[model samples]
Target: MSTNTEARLFSPTTIGAIGVVNRVAMAPLTRSRADMEGVHSELAIEYYRQRATAWLIISEATNISREGRGYAFTPGIYTDEHVASWRRITDAVHEAGGKIVCQLWHVGRMSHVSLQENGAAPVAPSAIQADEQVFLESQTVERPSMPRALETAEIQRLVEDYRNAARRAMEAGFDGVEVHAANCYLLEQFIRDSTNKRTDQYGGPVENRTRLPIEVITAVAEVWGADRVGVRLSPITRAVGDTPLDSDPEGTYFYLAGQLGKLGLAYLHCVEGQTRGDNGAGDFDFKRLHAKFGGKYIANNSYDRQMAIDAAESGHADMVAFGRPFISNPDLVARLRLDAPLAEANRDTFYGGGAGGYTDYLPLADAA
Candidate 1:
């Protein structure tokens, strides 16, 4: 590729009010390295500081409350200790000249009994059990236990939890937050009819199904402002416990894009497939979604240097987020700029480990 072509990926852009020097954004990846208390250790600060060259970095999916946790050692943003720990992380990233956003998550029915308080069932939009297993530091369940359906009033409270978490994120010194409404989590469970069989105002039709996500997004946007808030959506992903497809995937998500556009959020981040390159969900019409959103469009899942460059240069995306690639290539931007060979990430130490595969990845200068 020519210099001008590659320069498109390196060009500066603004997502809402935040000014970024390039369109390369780091996608959130779960490393599960936090302490049992949900306090991130110094290792996390080093891990993020290593990848601070990305124009923007989205932190791992962080629980907003104890009830939201589905995996062990994942970080949370609810307590004072958690806030203080995360402040160090955000400060380090900022000091390294990078912008980082926290991804707020609630795992919903994707929980095992061990993860729940007092052995209580996990909460979800409905009582459906995902055909998936939950992995903890000590054990793994064959399949997730059935979850308790959330009462209408309980959902109201959960929305408030999101708002409070956003406040906590700001207190922790994060640049912004991305609501994890994707991957069969609490919000996505409500949006899909197969999971939400309720007859009340929060189920049945598309309007009812989408109500929870809109309310949650609106609540978070209120705390952080819409310009500083983003939402991640998986329109056709079934990888996370085979989260059933929406009856009308097109209608459901198109309407969601339109509704999100009205909120004037900073951007809409979409995971294009299962993992990065496997489009297991098949083809999607990005143009329609772009038109519906009418805001910044961030494309994720399996983008290479050329693919990202093409997407930005061709006007298909306003930003591109790289996941696993950023794991091993802390200087991913520099490597792509020079067309250098990349490092391979070790699968064994991808999660819940020390600095082996986490912060040990050397930058290009060090390797050379």
Candidate 2:
């Protein structure tokens, strides 16, 4: 708990083309504060600017296209309006001396019919319905609609969507982009065998299952360069949709990691366990996975101050990402540096609210 000058967590490091002052990163979080059209509200600029001290701020999961939307009020980066709105946020964060990246997302089968175009069914690798609940425009949660299998020809279009989204991120003034391939989302649905039941090139074998995600990464890397791109992978997280873990998580992810390592990505932002729950260390060998990556690794999920420091000091991780903690602690980096107490966030104001919980949390200097 001592404020030691030698703490690796406080040391400066370069993540791809971006240089950060510390190793603490703000993980992507969904606050549902954007408009129905996926444009972020003006309040988001201040919200992100307040947390600018972190090494990097990964924006909440943003839909890559209209068909990619799952939850209500989540932002998108596929339109000119979306780009204009996000430009304001990126400019604010940069002016405050912080680095930010957009986490491009596509919900796939995790979406409800109400969220899709013309009330169409959600698309997935196969015709499987996730036992997941999605937040509707009415601010209510409902089980996702049954998804239709994506035709093999439609796969390239999904890749193009990711490419265009990455291009928009660049136009919006973001330093980089992170492909959201975790938490049973669209990309993860294809990566995992439990959900992907196709026999085509995108399914069946582990290599085939990971093809679309790899293709998406390749397309995004083409926009921002491989070093400026990161990918989020949850090897064993089944918390999102009650989706079962892949039958061979270690084999599946290790192969994917090795493949991504070949591309020389900025980092593999890994969710070490069940997000918002116990770290499922017993399920997979994270150390081996890190070695397989052969690049920077940003460890996430259930990490405290000491744990983050330990991971950095031991060289187990190049950086650490904190999710919920950053929600209530705008000056999270300072709090961790001083080992100060963190303010608890209100669960009620977590989604679809005004600035009450989003930007009202006072930093330590203001609180004192």
Candidate 3:
């Protein structure tokens, strides 16, 4: 394990109990390619199975409960049918000798009036409203409504939802579970301030803000074991309905990373983007945070092949996760390995669609 540049790319690494063949992971990007009920279809199975060459696959944001739904057609792990649908994909990946994990999520207040259970308003850490305009079909709509603050009891329920999702994921034959704390989801809303306006124990300072994520992580670890559970955090992505961030995000997340390290979880996944909704990587340094979270570090957002490989080689990241690139290049690993050109992603059919731009992206040969 020489700390040399070439060694970085060629190095074999272990993140907790899982062994990665190399440090390239398929980042979880929601394609909304599932059926309306959010079931994993044959299309998804084929899509993921093609990338078995990657070290691991983090499945798209999956709801653990009905109240967790935010985006339409996102998959769920809360129901029996959902588990059945997922098992097909996991089984396919396993047969191909690929490892995968289900990313457990609760979108919190990032939902619409029509997207919730019984069309109820979305829920969050507090009642603060974030009026992020989200796309639905051919229309742009403001975020559903001001979210109802969760009672202490409801918070506990959410933790249980995450735990149950972990159990179900294992039952469906997933290798592990990654708690989705990144991108201003439920956990981020709790961690960041602009959105979390509460006087309770779960709302104030950094410890309290981080409490929910820790509890959920601890709970999921109990089910899947710490070595098999991972957590993804985008310290910079203060998304649409999420929260505002720190004046010193680097120090903030560095502290948070140190805290997460104590749990002995498998890996700590992060992204290099501002939490602000500027469609830009927030302008802050990630050097300190990267050094501290020293386990398997997975970087996401706006990364291409050479840059991703550079991150891995520089020891800044253990692996690189490609979000948009993986969408159009199911054989993305092979493409990168062979230095082949990638097919451009179809923005038109990215979401709410059949296989037009979804599963129809051919490999390099077909593209030619």
Which candidate has the top score in TM-score?
2
Can you rank all candidates by lDDT, best first? 2, 1, 3
Ranking by TM-score: 2, 1, 3
How well does model 2 score by local distance difference test?
0.93
TM-score of each: 0.97, 0.98, 0.92
| Alpha-carbon local distance difference test for all models | 0.88, 0.93, 0.79
Clash count list over all predictions: 2, 0, 7
> How many backbone clashes are present in model 3?
7
Q: By TM-score, is 1 or 3 better?
A: 1
> Which residue runs of candidate 3 sit more than 4 Å off their true CA positions?
1-7, 135-142, 275-282
Error of 3 at 309 (Å): 2.3
Worst 10 residues of 1 by lDDT: 273-282
In model 2, the runs with Cα more than 4 Å from the true position are 1-5
- Per residue, candidate 2 scores C-alpha lDDT tens digits across 241-329 of 79899999999999999999999899999999998897666767998999999999999998998889888988989999999999999
Q: Cα miss at 246, model 1 (Å)?
A: 1.2
Which is the leading candidate under lDDT? Answer: 2
